[model samples]
Target: MQDHASPAIGISDLPAREEGYVDLRSYAAIGDGRTVALIAHDGSVDWYPMPNLDSPPVFARLLDSENGGCFELHPAQAHSATREYIPGTNVLQTTYQTGTGKVRVTDSLNTGKSGRLPWGEFARRIDGLEGTMELHWRVAPGTRLNRVSPWADSTRQCPLLRVGDVTLGVIGCAGEELNFSDRTVSGTITVEAGKHRLIALISTRHEPLPCPDPEHILDGIERTVSYWKSWSSELHYDGPWSGEVLRSALALKVLTHSHSGAIAAAATTSLPEDPSGGKNWDYRFAWIRDAAYTLHALIRFGEREEVHSAVSWLLRMIRKQGPDPEVFSTLAGELPHSEHEVDAPGWRGIGPVIEGNRVGGQLQLGVYGDLFDMIDLYLEGGNVIDQPTARLLADIADRTCDVWHQRDAGIWELTEARHYTSSKMGCWHALECAVRLAEAGQIEGEAARWQTERDRIKQWILQNCWSHERQSYVWYAGSNTLDASVLIHAMSGFDRSERMSTTIDAVQQELGDGPLIYRYTGMQREEGAFVACSFWMVAALAEVGRKAEAERLMAQLVPLANDVGLYAEMIHPEDNRFLGNLPQGLSHLALMTAALTLIEKY
Candidate 1:
């Protein structure tokens, strides 16, 4: 309920780092839809990936502090600092106050006049407010990630630097004019009142380099801010927690690729879920389940263009690849064929820092349900599908009936495959939606067989998955394990009776850590609380006619996000530190679904 415009705590001495690495909680994300950069509270842009969100980093101090590259600017020694998003926008402003004066550093990824990023352009503008403030800045493109040394040529029109395959045009680089031996740039400046300076970086992958003048670079910063504000203004929800909802929408927007409309799971990858060591994952790839959830959320906010782009991209890739779609893909719809434990040390020395996701080949029965649910929502939103898409959905529905009984990785993507209760519910939900589509003549399929199979799934779950002693659905058929993922079925209209109502309380009692909920019963020891599970429970509670309880839980979970309202894939329950990849798309998507579910009832 606190205003995001108000600073969370007073501006104190800037955060200190441990072994050259700041806490994951200290990072906030800025992007131009394609590239996302993580700027820490200490004024360091630590994790920046050029070309796209899933690409290798240009500045990777987030992974390896010692040798990883970074774009940094801050007070030379000691300065107090506070940070916030420029209201209703992804542009970040950091205030630095030293003994002599105050200054603000505004950061953003520059977009074109058409309000889209055609290539990578990073703009950092410094403006002086009070007396003279001395600041230091650096541009070091580290080579540890891809194992290629950086090369620079000061002889070019602009200082040109190449890190791996990408070439960078460093404009307004403030270092000495003839300094190119070290392949890095560093400078110091004294800003008196009313003084301003600019540092812009333009990068290209395989194409010719871009030329951006100082005046246009400054103008690009304002233009990017304008684009973000205009995008946020189109959302039309004014219910309770609307401020937090809008921030979540903006965060999801940061994860949504403007060109392809495929939303990455998170901004950065290999941030450990278990801070002490293992369980690091590369979540930058676009998963079908996550994108489907994103589609559902954006539809609720009446987002048209993003929704259309995502739907088109998903179907095009699926049709091209076949009805049994691959689990995840690149932003450009390519199936990822490469994954590696890269050379860099991980955040806080968590080893085996990875680049691409390794779990894409796993069989997850829930994906069919996610796909159909998204298609159903898209149709209900008053859109028409082509004949090919309709036939594709029908083919997928037939395949779902064949594979629903197979033991596979559940929604949690755990290694031990089983007949997960939620997985069956997902299949059932998919078939049920297919039946409705067939009844409405949307998708051509065996409506009668789908209906029959849906009933069989319902009966099987009732007979084998229910636990008489616990009065709740089990995680799998034989075990009594509690899973928060089953709560998702409530919103899908799987169950709305006394059994589901009782199961909600039982899962909360077993999985809840106040407002935070573990993914399953025994997961508290392995990782932090899963962020999306808590929001899924809120929707389940509201769906089963427990409005007051849902509201109370919603109130608690809304403020649990970071100061700028971005969430990690998980949150440490004890210290509230971020765990897993940051600015997770599923967390924000779940937040929107929970809020819309609550608003629809009122």
Candidate 2:
């Protein structure tokens, strides 16, 4: 409620870190399935993708430090910080220790017990830990993907704004104002031990402010905490790394889209992995590969409802393509027709924060494998696949038979056309899962022909995709290049034999960095160690009966998570800074899969 545009200590006068940069892993993220909040270690919400997962960020200080608006709550002085989510929930508690005192900031995005929400609300509670400490606050609403700079106004009671049909109100609980702009606000406050303050950002597009009393906020906080505790209590993980597993479950829960059951790749888009490399890409959409892995994680954790919701979303997304096939869509289930850069400067010089994904139009053959496997998994659980969905599956499988030999954009969605062997193997995976599904009475398909097609695809891959000289599978048919994606075959049951174990070791030596691994060579410096590849390596290790190695590798990955137990698309092992989008669905889902695989096997 208190705004301090001017800091009492003038830290704002200091220039921000250079562009194309961030204090890597400085923030933890929390979400309510509808929207996500990024909380910095120093207790600032530097970025939030608002209204929807794919919407332009309204608060985007992470992208533009000086002009972009952010909400911060940290100790008055320079402080040391460590934070984590409450046991198994998305509520993050960050503790800051200053020369004078210590303080704790609990950050959460309010959600209902039924895994639903009245609307999206990001709430922060500040509790003094020792002597008095100073806290700062700022709110700057940005255009989605950091495009438009909307105006902000305070009318004594609330910070109100009108943009199109959207109406927003920012309310503070224990502070007063510093400065208010048509598009930004900042302030500072003092607090002592045993005292507390609260702040809430509420969105109301067509409705009244529904202004609740401060007492009501206190009540909401207690209720929300209790609900998350009860929900997480249902998890069944009991392993050597139960703590990491629980954290992964909580992160996956935060990424879940309550209304549609879709889980986004990450909360924000186009945050570069290598700040100096210009390797930025938007990750605010859903991928079928992530959905399949996320469902398994939810199921392993006994979150049947979330699993069901994710399945429904997957079905709806695929069903919308109407028995024909295309790449996946945004979490809202809309196709990404194209991509273009916004006019704004990149986050710390990471240029061209892209909007929309042209990859949606490319033939990502791997998607077919992910989809059929998800459907097979759902059926194996004794869940019924609807007739329409079954029909769609068969049609897609038939199409895979027709197109299995074609080149694709590849799993990384690279722009060039290449004979990506993993893409063809993905076709094999689809046909294999389809045959199994038909045998299990899940669909009506040409089971014999599909089986024959599956065998033929395998034969083709064995002859063309493998590199005899390297004694391992390569990225494509003719090249000796290695891709981390081939590790999935060993884990996906496409090949769990001795050859896979050798390939796994080869991948470790060739592409693995410490326990983290890359998808492939920079291939022109477009990527870092793809985080999901590392998880695939973890799962593959477990499947090949290398339990201890898998656990050790898994241990290495847990620390890579930011304080809130979230992961991006990739990581630089040397520096351990998260690259790509925050809380990426593939990364988190892969983490979940690796955890479950270790628990189930070891």
Candidate 3:
């Protein structure tokens, strides 16, 4: 093991900022399948939650730059920075170039023999590539930043930072004597050419402080990188935009809960869809719609193991927790509760940072379509569905038939429930997919009854949703508003006629901002365009036999992804800046699906 006795250095002034915030696009994420850390271009770990993704953040400077905690390691002088992931892995490398020298910093959340380390370990390795550079480093454990009282205590071997039930051990420093003040530990050191250093923060909850072994920590980094590369190598996509597809797959994998097989809608929450506060909501929990789409994308790439685990988990959740399950749930399959505000200021001073989602109680009819489509895709991929799951699937199809005419939240989960055209179309899709499955002998269902209901729903949508005045399907009955969600009908195989193609043109005329599409009629005026909607348009175009147009629009849409090939929930049309949650599963899933469609068309 490497030495741990090097003395710490005194604290230095916190890094200065232009606006005290980094653009969401300027950050890359690293994770160990349990929790993720957001590292900015300037080498600051500004957002991280210890132990788990849903836990309160220990380093939240991304929210409250002045008071929230962060771990920053950067050159003392000014420098231009660039970053990338180690190929096929989540391990991130950031390079800084100054007037006289250059340095590279590698960051990773270490993985162990079984998988993610039971105890949290964040390791950073810095190497001087040329000349010499002075690096300033700090570990400011915000202790959830005043959520609880935190203090530092000196142990016989090293100092420990304690907050509530968790203890953080800081080790592998090679600076001056370490100083702990104001709930922060920091130091400065000089690294010359051909020299290097390592630092780590190991955390354990309600457990004894474990010694940090530097050599073992270094080995963990190699193992973690190898683990990610091995996983990436197993992916089977050989289609158009293969790199982007693989990156999306990797991002979706990062958001998955290793133990429960649940995938979060996004990695970070309360990052606003609109810079103005109200649109911000927590997305750390699993939504059935999002999970279904994620599984669909994975299944397209022949990711059997992940698909099976996720399907099994969902079936178990449905069997135990459903007749009608909540729109969203915890990774462990329990329904999420009400939304509440966190104490931290939201990103860029937007207030009322939220902790939970409020839409859990709403009725979204589209979920049945999503679930049945996921099951259909899995079965088509030669996977077997358990008897109980098949029964549940049949029951859900029947329920969709029973509820197709009812008013419920649409695909957007709008608070005002209505007879959304998309919801009815989804019901139609559920029944149709069920009929097909029953015909294939993949499941036991009332195929004749399902077909009858499916035809009824199709007729209902045609009669009520079509707007002759607008020459397209309206967002809902009696409203002239156009919703991008109707684009899903083309992908769902609801309509391949000339009317569907005309509807696509009308949707683009009203809701499209070139390649970026809005979720609904008026969202572009208030907030960013929904990223997934653009990809949905790509799928719809290809489905309508406009392959060249689909490829052209896709070419525009792919460039909007951030440097690391990850997408947020929305994008500012004018600035092209990312908005809302980072590493959004829906956005990535849409991208993957669009790529699959384009490849098939070509």
Candidate 4:
């Protein structure tokens, strides 16, 4: 351990990028429950947003390497690096081994005593494990990619970075002075054997930002690590792939907003799904569908508090904004504003980085089922349903009955409205779950009407969505194309018949590349196979009693996760590179579900 306030000598010069770009898979995530930071294997904090997850990123080097800002602390000489989490915690440890020496660096976004800190706190601890090693550090805040220019204020005890209304302060304990130039703070320190160093970056939105004593910041890091470890200790899971399941659970917890209980779909945005730069969308907001799946995974692992809080937050949002909520909303329960393109060049020079989600207004009929399933899971976990939530569930169930037949955007949220088979099946599942709840006396509802509509929705799916010619349920009515989402019937219990088994085979044949499955027809040629859909296929395989195939697919898909077991929304099939938003909650949740299904069935 090292003293927190020990000053380090300043190095006036900056180091140039040795590597032109980093692979998306080379980044691992750490968060403080309010926002996440993506750190590359080379010890650079590439993507981080100050104050909140959706705020403009102060470090956007992941999107634009040259102009975007970053905080980097690595060996001045060439080194080989490997990293891992501090077991059961989001704190990451990276070890760099050079010809002459080895050094270990631990990174964390410190949480406060109670919950999230009012301001952001990032810490990097460096230790000399072998011989002496010279380490260089630079703190460069992008100010939303120069949308706001940054100024250095050296009048304080420690240097302060001022950009608009926000301020960032850098401090360390190495007995060296820091140099400030061009809004960047640069320093160098040599750590001999048995010596260590601690450097931190702190940010605040309020004017006259408070810079706590360095010793206090160090205490916060220790407390934050303990907090995460305690939370992980509470998780109860003994199924197959328990390690991966716990990793996914921890990743989901990182995505969860401590203040509002809203779980973001992912921590990042505008990591292109397509290399041609066509399909990029922001995923920092909460989607009803994604949140429902996240809850399902968490519930399986005996997580109760966050699930209850999330359900309560969602119900409150529904009450405030009415029963028909947006497909997505901010963590605080407001519809996200219109989508706009940012000026920053996207990852790999992909243009038109997006800000807000445009699909919030889309009528995704599956949300009805998503909400119902979340409530059912909560009640199944022995949690009581309040009166208002019970009534809201009943009303929403009735509304689903009324709108099950109408055409709308399906689970994929495509622009075109169609009689999607999966959407109708979702309504059927919702009504069926509602009927079961009514039978159990959890809520007051008309079971007969709900059953009748459920059967009707089933009949419609059987009549229109199925393609006898293709021997599978098509993506929608009157279309022969296969959809990966229809595999949800396996988990939703919409169907367990042999037809679903054949449909699973049909989907694999048409859209799957071995264990990885595309989202729908023709997607393999356009973009990478969706990582979630592939996991869904694994679950569906288990549901169909294809234990051998399920196990094989699980083995294949599990390795697709990066070194730290984090997943992005998509992966390029050709290169196995991560694409789209990282630490994707949907992908992690789907992986957990598939693991659970395999453990239960086999």
TM-score of each: 0.96, 0.91, 0.95, 0.95
Over 40-75, each residue of candidate 1 has an lDDT whose tens digit, in order, gives 888888999878888778888999997788988888
Alpha-carbon shift of residue 566 in model 2 (angstroms): 2.3
Give lDDT per model, in order. Answer: 0.86, 0.73, 0.83, 0.84
lDDT of 4 by residue, 526-565 (tens): 7888999999988988998888988888889887788777
Q: How many residue pairs collide in each prediction?
A: 0, 24, 4, 9
Writing each residue's lDDT as its tens digit, candidate 3 over 455-524 gives 9998988899999988899999989999989888888899878888888899899898878999989897
- TM-score rank, highest first? 1, 4, 3, 2
Error of 3 at 214 (Å): 0.7
Candidate 1 Cα lDDT to native: 0.86
Which digits, one per residue and each the tens of the lDDT, describe model 2 over residues 163-203? 43455676664347567777666678677899987777777
Indicate the residue-level lDDT of 501 in model 4: 90
Model 2 is weakest, by summed lDDT over 10 consecutive residues, at: 1-10
Error of 3 at 31 (Å): 1.1
Those runs of model 4 whose alpha carbons end farther than 4 Å from true positions after fitting are 1-20
Q: Could you say which candidate leads in lDDT?
A: 1
The total number of steric clashes, by the backbone 3 Å criterion, in model 3 comes to 4
How much is 593 displaced in model 2, in angstroms?
A: 1.9
**RMSD per model, one decimal:** 2.1, 5.1, 5.2, 4.8
Q: Model 1 clash pairs?
A: none
